[model samples]
Target: MNEINNILYITGAGVSEESGIPTFRGKDGFWKIGSKNYTPQEMATRRMYKENPEQFLSWYYKRFAAYRNHGPNKVHHWLANKNLITQNIDGLDGKAGNQNYIAIHGRLDQMTLFHTQGDNVATQQAPWDSVDETSLTESLLEVFKISLSTRKPMKSQSFKPYVLLFDEYYTELYRISEAQQRMIDADKIIFMGTSFSVNITQMALEIAVTQNKPIEVVDPYPVRIPYENTTYHRMKASEYIERAD
Candidate 1:
């Protein structure tokens, strides 16, 4: 294989699975373990946050908070120096010292004001440490700036998780424009550990197809794309890195 230049690596949950983070789509994944009254699809949405804040916060805290400290694996370390756009909210790529990568799906360790996208709001570090699961509801309410007495989010005071909810669209908050520009400028696009289910992957693939750029998919069971210059690496992300090295 020739040395590929201007390569943009678009990663997904599969990349973080090696670091003991759940892909959230497997049979035992987080999405499969929804709350008593809601499915994961329903629970992970803006509607849920607005209508049932307690359940939403509780579910998010239980599932995503536990993996907040997972260290990056070899794949993350290898991709650290490369042009990258990861779909993971785990924030492991940043942990691996990749300062320039885009986390298109937002991040678990961050929070923003409860405002719509493209609203030019600022984000801050989430106060996960202040939460106690024993008093999960109240703790989340306090940390997220919700009112305990009314069980409603305080206007302008309440905050939302940095994650891109199910019903939310990509916006400047997630750096969607920069990511799209990266896709357009790349000479080659490599998708690692992704199932090609999300919009970002599809967007990248479309760009690659239209621009006639080489495409690579790395996974244990790679999804085949019908492009002329596409390649498939049927292996784990770490395995692919080792082979490349």
Candidate 2:
């Protein structure tokens, strides 16, 4: 039996940040006092968008801008081949050449939505990440109300960032279904960089921890998962792969 046929992997922002992407929270990663500290849940929820379209759009656009020109780093490229799963929106894990992974948080490399009115809007960027500067222009940029007098920013695909924002249920349920099956089917799960923020992480951790799957977590500053006999390596994703390679 292929020991890893049932192998499941999950990742979080810590892994993506290694590739030069900016995360909502940094290791030393928070805006200082007096600055707006929008909780990830608050800023990333569907309710925020419904109540404040302008703010949501503006914040998302700026947030999306951080990923331009970045490519998957060594860790992402390596783990992509491990029958992986990730919560990152950066799309780097798959682009890094991991063939069997899914982006649980949704992908920034594509944009989409299923409107209540039955409108399904979507745009795909192939051979590159949807976060690529060109993808934004070709797909999503026009929704912004900008003037032609000054050069306008390229549009992201017309749909949202393809991410699962708060108040959004469809993608969340879909991702959870797949992940649950993966967890149930797998004998081992290697979790890297996820902060247990969403239901996905929480659920997977609950299952894996309960099942006593051999799990490993890798990070420069690894958290202490309060479980007996789980291994944690304190190192950057790149460093881990370099040694493993």
Candidate 3:
């Protein structure tokens, strides 16, 4: 347990399945991929957000079923109880009892959208219809939280996916924070469940290795990808949870 303090955890979809979200990439025999399934980049992009906001929101909200069907599980619960950085935004980390953490890609429970640079928004929810204000970044923290806590679509505020989409630059990218930088610069990085599909996030891993840090890659399959200095573990996420106290 003491070793975890030196840890930087980068979790992906696999870590979330225990909470009931389906990842079409992993082979648990649950979700089958089809030609119709939109490439994550296509479905979750700024262009889509503008061209078809409702469709984008629908795909995202339905996938983020944890908002309604499930809660945090042993792994997320365990991470919250610890002091490690994570890459998930399923809100399980919060439910797991951890309040302070960095979401490298973004979060599903928060909302961010394109508004005129200086315009103010009130909340981040799905099927967001509000036009004058449509981003979570523009609102106060208290007001934003209230916007997500309810189910009704408001006449004044809109709620969009809190998760950063394919082509959208993060609000943090313009000015990187210290804690986020530290998490990226850890002595040991542990990756769980995510297939390294996106180039931007993959860049972070590249940065970590370039700095001479060692990485431990954990997944159900041991298939190797590029980049040296990574240790691999072939095991299901649930397998570890089964043994945890």
Candidate 4:
């Protein structure tokens, strides 16, 4: 461990699984909405939010509220000492006091008022801290002055979840360049709880493969996509961390 510096941990929803926050692609997946059959990609789009702000906000806020009660697990705490690039929006890493990490996918605990210019864009809040559904609905109605039937914004003034929606590009992400550079610079790349299905994981893995660096993956199952020079540990993320000695 002493020889390791510039550590890059490419993390996914599995890291937070021990904390009782479900993985995004698990059986009860992010897109596993009820009978509506709307996928997470559909629900988390800007268009969905615009078409029916109330319904969109309700879905997002409810999920955010569920995440609020869960604190980070041991794996998150262990990762605090490393340079992390996480695909999770649950904000567990931040809650674990891992300030050195980059949340490439955005975070649920934070939000910003969109359409604000310059310095005003920085005004952010933990939606669960002060946002109430009733007040949010009232505010959307007041700000947009849209008819109930149409549900379209007359004038656009809205709060944006500090996350990358399905339609959003990595350019819209915060610190994406920094995250990429860290991935490139790291001599050691460790992956935890990722299924290799998302773009971020693909990017990280590609860099590792190109660099010919050794890869350590901690997951109970085999990695979804195999890579050369990778050592796999068959255990949950927290278990792997605890047994790292």
By TM-score, the best candidate is 1
Instruction: Give stretches of model 3 more than 4 Å off.
Output: 1-4, 27-40, 65-67, 83-85, 112-159, 173-180, 223-228, 241-245
**Residue 214 displacement in candidate 3 (angstroms):** 1.5
The order by descending TM-score is: 1, 4, 2, 3
5: Cα error in model 4, Å: 3.1
TM-score list, all predictions: 0.97, 0.75, 0.69, 0.85
Kindly list the per-residue Cα lDDT of model 4 for residues 1-245, writing each as its tens digit. 46766668889888888888777777886656522546667778777766776666657766555677788888888888778899898888888888878988878777665542222245365546555456776544443344566666433345666777776667534677898899899988889988887788888889988998778888888575567688888888878877884
Q: Sort every candidate by lDDT, greatest first.
A: 1, 4, 2, 3
User: Each model's C-alpha lDDT?
Assistant: 0.91, 0.62, 0.57, 0.73
Model 2 per-residue lDDT tens digits across residues 1-245: 55555667778888878677765566444211111446545777666654544455445655654464689887877786686778777778767787667777777666554243223445454223333444453232334322223323223312344667767654442356676788878888777776666677677778888888777878777777777757887887777778767
Model 3 lDDT, residue 233, Cα: 78
Candidate 3: TM-score? 0.69
Candidates 1 and 2 compared: the better one by lDDT is 1
**Which is better, 1 or 3, measured by TM-score?**
1
- C-alpha lDDT of residue 200 in model 2: 77
For candidate 2, the 10 contiguous residues with the lowest summed lDDT are: 27-36
Candidate 1 colliding pairs = none
Could you tell me the lDDT of residue 6 within candidate 4?
67
